[model samples]
Target: MTEKLFSPYQFKSLQLQNRVVMAPMCQYSVTAKDGIPNDWHQVHYVSRAVGGTGLIIIEMTDVEPDGRITDQDLGIWSDDHIPAFAKLVDGMHAHGSKVAIQIAHAGRKAQDASQPVAPSVVTFPGEAYKEPRALTTEEVVAMVHKFAAGVRRAVQAGVDAIELHGAHGYLIHQFHSPLMNHREDVYGQELSRFGVDVIHAVKKEMPADMPLIMRISAIEYADGGYDIDHTLQVARAYQEAGVDIFHISSGGEGPSGQRKPGNYPGYQVPFARRFREELHVPVIAVGMLEDAALAQAVIGNEDADLVAIGRGMLRDPYWANHAALELGVSKEHAAIAEQYSRGY
Candidate 1:
């Protein structure tokens, strides 16, 4: 049978040469602390593009300076940041890869922010984490605009798609989490309200044909954290608000309790499968799926529409190319860069 992992996939205007995605992993390499993409990021991502990855989701890029987890994290808060991002986007496109930016706010996870903010006054459990100040109702409204502005900048930078960081205890995740949000307002009453609003706002900034992807944690590992049932309800609201794809991930909220996250390959595939089945949308499954055959199995088994490789890609920029070789994809479909043809 033809390897599904090597097959092309498309959603809206974004088309991928294969079903492999380089998952958005924070680089934390912005030395200037100004949220600009530097040479380090350029080479890091472009190398993967050359390596034949179908879709490259740029790292967790913040909407504001203080919204970053650290000063080193990338940000798209300013129009000035567009040129640098556009350069990266252009580089990726030149190599036959479609690019997406994961727009996010670290919220209470902003370790360097003197006053990190969240849905309520809850503090993320960590020595480096601070007690986050609760955003006033007005600030919440403005925050949605900030998210939209970030998406606008990303669109201007020529990203093929947009992934709102709603997972891993980020700002959007904090708002939707019952444990993190304990306010008496509408946002607290309606957990998915904040995410839904951000989706609506960002959707307005995006081209009508551009797909809006939302990464969500299917289940939180923290004690008293939510389960898949609650997240499915939240995702339903996001879908209604206009999320075209769901990237299912898990557990960045806090420390694990009795329900610990699995530490094996394909462990999270079930969650991705569940989300796809329930939401009836294309979903990206991400975890420890580095093995070529395993990655191929994910697509062949219809467990996920796409598989995102994080640590695997970090370890090998040419992971997709190598995986293609391992899976015996034909040269015509393998997409190996001509410059590296001899090596392959």
Candidate 2:
């Protein structure tokens, strides 16, 4: 039998309903500014869960104020936001989906309508960027605290797993990228130190049984920025720090990587496949994957342990259910949250 997309895969302890992970795509429809979760969040996520995604990873939520990409990002730093997210998570679980929260600090990529905030005050050749105040060492320490508190809230909200958003030039990733982090201090000089401190704090606060995954941009796609060499090194250390999975993505290539290399099916799988061998960790591959054949091929070839679908699901919310039917996925797997009598 061909391994189905919704097959249950055991990751140490937690069981994911399927390999069809809903990649964290920003919806930008939060409570706005306050970083609170509201009805919008509840509906947006539940829709995907209801649509038959195996794992419904929530949007890129902020761990702090300056982390907001726009005024519409969801936040978990405060306990007040838990009830709404709890409802969302509960509803998703009720609909038969494992949930993962993709949490991050936006760092210098913080933006308003037109202005972008960045680590150093390097003007982007006339792109109205915010003159970000370099975060003090004390402030950095506080940010770590915020991440721990956010995880606690995620646990309260009842998410099945946690995906630390360390990719795409966000706060944690910005520090990891040489182009963005220009500080001469430890954070700036030591490109890999920031993520370590974060995982250290997060691990301390998390329950031993909960699965923690790192969502990372394995390549910066830019020449002067983060590259495969640096990212692989970071992954080695991160696995040692105890993450259960590595969610791989690309871009933030600065300028050189901006060539619109038209999206091809599994365009980014090579990175994940390489990381799987180098890091020896479960890797989640996300890119232009849309077909069941291609996804099966990736998993079958051991290119990646799992495949993450973004636009494909958006194109078809019931992508997993239908794909499961076509690929003949098991209906009795533990990862199957709750199966609908009829396909979406």
Candidate 3:
């Protein structure tokens, strides 16, 4: 029987062979403090691509230096960074695994001691972030350009897709989540408009064939975090704004303990499914979607269209192939680099 995990998912341009997607993870490796792609990134992503994962979403890349979360985050605000990303793309494509890049700005979550900016003057629980200087209307408009340019760099690097980082209290998240965005401007009043503008603007620069995914933490995971009900509305708005897949994540800002009770495998699937049922668009269910059976159930039950794996993929890169075996089907590690194969 062809299991749910083995089924194909069709985005705008590429066809993903399996419902399993490698979640974009921050490895905290950066070279020259420019957020440029380095060797660490090359091996990290290519390893997973070759390990039989379906599509790999690269880590959160800074659109500008001030948007960085730390000294080690990847960046794509310039043309120089594209060359390195292109190499990473070549390796990923060699393994037959499609790739996506998550472009972001850290908002108030920028590097320690450096003045970080956000829609409001907020601070993460215990992270080292400088007091942010709120952006003027002109600066806000400039941020859009920076974000759009990141898409161009990713496209030049030959990636198949691009996911805007709108979760976890980053720049977009700051705008989307009311708990963080305390501004009184047009950007602040419209919950949907905060992220929609950038997503829509980015579409212009991104490859037409490339699918654009909006990765959002459906719930802000804080006491006064963005409301889930409102987020559902935001989900619909993004679809209208030209998003291809809704990658649902949860919690990053405010108090983490205030999050909804459950976080087990497939726990977050319902949120993704709800968006899918309501919006009728592709949704990638993320967070703790580890086990093969759990992942299978989410897709089999029509709970979500895709399962995104983070720690699980790190725990075992050959998860997709193994999952295929358990589900009584066939999948290959053809994406794995030849050098890493045992019998080479």
Q: Which candidate is the best by lDDT?
A: 1
Query: TM-score, each model?
Result: 0.99, 0.90, 0.93
lDDT winner, 2 or 3: 3
Alpha-carbon RMSD to native, per candidate: 0.8, 2.7, 2.4
Q: How well is each residue in 1-344 modelled by candidate 1, as lDDT tens digits?
A: 45689998989898889999999998877474599999999999999999999999999999999999999989999999999999999999999999999999999999999999999999988799999999999999999999999999999999999999999999999999998999889899999999999999999999999999999999999899999999999999999999999999999999999999999999999999999998899999999999999999999999999999999999999999999888889988887999999987
Q: Is candidate 1 or candidate 2 better by TM-score?
A: 1
The residue pairs found clashing in candidate 3 are 35-75, 50-335, 50-336
lDDT of 1 at 225: 95
The segments of candidate 1 whose C-alpha lies over 4 angstroms from its true place after superposition are none
- Please give the RMSD of candidate 1 to the true structure: 0.8
Write the residue-wise lDDT of candidate 3 on 1-344 in tens digits: 35567777787797787778999888886463578877778888888877777899999998887787787788888898989999999998888788889988888888642788888877666656677888887789888889999998899899999999888778888787777777788888886676788988899998777899988887866676666788887777888888988898877775665556365677778788888888888889988878888888888888888899999998887777767666666434233346654532
Clashes of each: 0, 6, 3
Model 2, span 81-102: residue lDDT tens: 8888888889888877888898
Using lDDT, rank the candidates from best to worst: 1, 3, 2
Question: Model 1, residue 166: displacement in angstroms?
Answer: 0.5
Scored by lDDT, model 1 comes in at 0.95
